[model samples]
Target chain A: MMEQVRVVLDHAGDISPISSEEYLRIGGYQGLKKALEATETIIDTIKASGLRGRGGAGFPTGLKLSFTANTQADQKYIVCNADEGEPGTHKDRIIMVEIPHRLFEGMAIAAVAVGASQGYIYLRAEYPYVATILEQALADARRQGLIGSNIMGSGVDFDIQLFIGAGSYVCGEETALLDSMEGKRGEPRFKPPFPGVQGLWGRPTIINNVETLSNLPAIMVKGPKWFRSMGTERCPGTKLFTLCGNIAHPGVYEFPVGTTIRTLFEEVGGGCPRGKKLMAVQTGGASGNIIPASLLDTPMDIDACAEAGATFGAGDLMFMDEDSCLLDVLENLTEFFEEESCGKCTPCREGNTQLLRLIREFRNGTAQEGDLNLLLELSNVMRGGCLCGLGQSSPNPILSVLRFYPDLFVENSYRKGDLAYA
Target chain B: MTTREEQLCVLEEVAAIAAKWRDRPDMLIPVLHEVQTIAGNCIPKEVAMTVAREMRIPLAQIYSAATFYSFFSLEKRGKVLIRLCRTAPCHVKGTKETLSAFEQALGIKAGETTPDGLFTLEICECIGACDVSPAALVDDTVYGHLTPDKVRELVASLQETEGSR
Candidate 1:
């Protein structure tokens, strides 16, 4: 049995999330104090910790911070990507609602490292209640001198404001998030000049995920070597996996990055409910690839999952029992991309529309023999041509289904008398 | 339909919200949120124009921002908007039946509002409550683990509260 190893969720249930004193009692903001004392080494220490972004893309945190730190700007900014819009992922919400001070302290550490004075928490519109909790936490932090000007008499003036995102899934994309923060339509900006160099009103900005930032205090308090002791050498630290769908224990579980899918399913999730057999699992969120039950031993790390032709996006594990239809699942996933395409680029807008049509044909038992190839061909086009990550990864579900369960398409389409076009 | 005076009152309320945010172009979404609240759950044309004029932004830009997000509705919605989760996690956990239950209880489909302006039924992509599959957002609060009986009871309670009010 693989028990949870809580690192980011260190003070989740024990502390009052709104109280800064409770957080302080448990040694919160000590990381910021340490970072302040040795400001120059903060970035280097983070780099050595081997922490990566927890917002789907596993970009190295220290590398991202260095980009903004190196850039010469009059006023740089730090933005926390709290827009937890991934379909099955709510780990960031848990971190924000449970241990908001940890997130604030983390942001303050980053702000001090990068010489940034302003910070923004781009919270999603759906979690309005969570926003209130964060708002109170921010006020308490401000009152306690944890945030605001001259934090702990360190002469580092830093403050954070919460910006509520109107409901757009694409806004979860960092560039789109910056555009939305500037009060424009939440369309993703072209990246050549990434947000690290020119972002949020053409100023150098660093946007870190809520979970990634939440890990900073722990990493700062415990040295880099201690941080790297638990997880794999390349991908260090624990991940909060949001387990849901067909499982007995469907909630957030904190485990090391290299944990296997089988341990997650059988030991942690207690297997499928009502003694049903697990047929398939979709790691990551809606945009992640689906893996068949046969490959249950694949380790849940960034490099390992990539080697297994999957992504450990935001660490979401959505299980499916034998009774579930993969075709029906594909249709739901396709429709999501279709509705959320944003229409800024032709490949994503038109590609998702046509992809949904093709998937629907298979679902309705009217798919032609050549339609499957057409689906794969279009997915490749979108993957290569789309402007942002949303469009680029929209076809992940279809591609994975084609890779693992190509027989599902054939079986669903060959139903007797239902094949109108055949 | 609102009278001209009532529309003016809504415009006045929207102007205050715009001013509160300093009429900055970057504060358009926040301003629109307040405008939508005052305009009875939708940003009607006059309210949009009021915001555009107050914020000194192009009406086209305001409309683009409003239409881009699913949260901001251009059309009027019910007093209690029920946004059901339509993602795969919820779908596999029987959200289709939960959706049907909501439709049956409200006497309307997914995109319609009750005749009395009491409730609006809509399907949203995800609210990240998959742990409690078959989840829904009744206004801003989330209700999870829904069933047909639960849906009926929730609708009845909502209607009863509105009746008492």
Candidate 2:
């Protein structure tokens, strides 16, 4: 039996039982209703759950709310980063479209707990379906009195709005997302006066990942311990992994945090398709580095992945089978960064573009010896110098590919005698 | 597979959504979604501009909203739009090869709609149906485990099926 809980998409979607009542029947806002009564206890529950931010850096969700709760800002904003901009990640969008209402419930309760009146879902342009789902959910929430002034008549007023983002991958960064929400280009703004301190219209804004927001109501009802009881110590609850690549099963997978990477491959995904060997896995979209085959036994727990030099950013797992060339794979990711770079910073704009050219030249077997060294040097520069992750983590793919499979980068190209990742 | 009349009906439906929430500047997101679903894709400057005038919102604001969301298409798509997943997961499953095959069969490149208004080839990021490696969505139907051979068969069947319809 599939133990699936579509909290957001309670009754499927627009074609069927697409109403709050239908959602309610399936135990939907029971969490929110429970949350209103247990307002003060919400953060502790989340902290006990050991739930961490799914969007890149795995910061504890409970700690984020705790910081906001203690902050002296007169106005706090509950911002949901729904911009599912990660190349391989689509779990958030799936959850959003399937059940926008659940996310709204999560957002609303979060607003009440954090004492925020305004909420925004900052979605990316790629996911047009989400905007519709979210809009409909907000309407439903308003009509049901789950949103708007005094939600559920609990005297907690919150207005959730949808804010669309331009095609800038950097906006996935919390600060940059805030900047974009402020009617500016989606560029990464520096930290210090972080969004938790000064965000949106310069108030204390707690930007939560869509998945983070989606998980809120559950934490409220279940208690932090109930949530914590599911996963490993320190990394509790379920982390939704958007599995892609040459795997047999490629879709959104919800599993306990410490599930081994091998289990995700052999069991959940049914292993690599076409009998191909799993060479390396790119965990957490582009920012996360490739976990080599030697590390396939590595568990996907937050700290576990982080210890291996990969932040499980939004849990986007991309599996690269043996047959695919590593150089092309690295170049492919670089081109996306180049196309979606936003060009606000010099290192990313110029460096990523040049990186693409250099990679192409190297692939074409025309790379000078110095060019290889130059590529390495340029990657380091782009990583440190760029204002955002698009540029900062740009070298991850190259470095991972280079370290794990140096043979993929022969004197140039795949060597004539090289075996096909046997 | 809608008639021009049905298409126009969708526009009317969109217009109604726009009219209903004209007072709330916040209703822009919903209004756009309904309109886009009706319009097939959001194109024609007039669609947004008309909303701007009727809703009394700035054109800049409408355009900004339209451009920000990925669903709003600014131009006409071919009758059958074939967007293959090109993101990391899809890439792992040889999306490049699938795209190459699509371009090969269509005699066109990425983002190009065929001359007869039949097929448009695009490389979209992982459509999030990663449970099926190397997926391609033809309008709403998702095709997984795509190969160069599958591409040829799909293009052939789509054209034939369109003719029969």
* Best-fitting candidate, scored by lDDT: 1
lDDT over C-alpha atoms for residue A244 of model 2: 77
Q: Write model 1 residue lDDT over A58-133, tens digit each, in one string.
A: 9999999999999998999999999898888888989988999999999999999999999999999999889899
lDDT of 2 by residue, B1-165 (tens): 258677566656666777786756656765675676556555557577767776778888887756654445677667677778776667766787888889988888998888776777877754655666578878767787888999899888888997787
Q: Which stretches of candidate 1 lie over 4 Å from their true place?
A: A417-422
Candidate 2, residue A89: how far the Cα is off, in Å: 1.9
How far residue A165's Cα lies from its native spot in candidate 1, in Å, is 0.7
Q: Compare the candidates by DockQ and give the number of the best one.
A: 1
| Clashes by residue pair, model 1 | none
lDDT of 2 by residue, A1-422 (tens): 23533333335454322367767776778788887887897777777777788777778888888888888877899999887778788888777867677788888777777788999888876555566667776787789887888888888789888887644567778887876665444567777777877887788888988888888877776677677677788777787877777777777777777888888878887788788888888887865687787887878887788787655777777887888766777778877777777677899999989999988876776665567678789989988888877888888888767766665566454343423322
**Where is the poorest 10-residue window by lDDT in model 2 chain A?**
A413-422
Error of 2 at A94 (Å): 3.5
Q: Positional deviation of A296 in candidate 2, in angstroms?
A: 1.4
**DockQ score for model 2, please?**
0.27
* Best-fitting candidate, scored by TM-score: 1
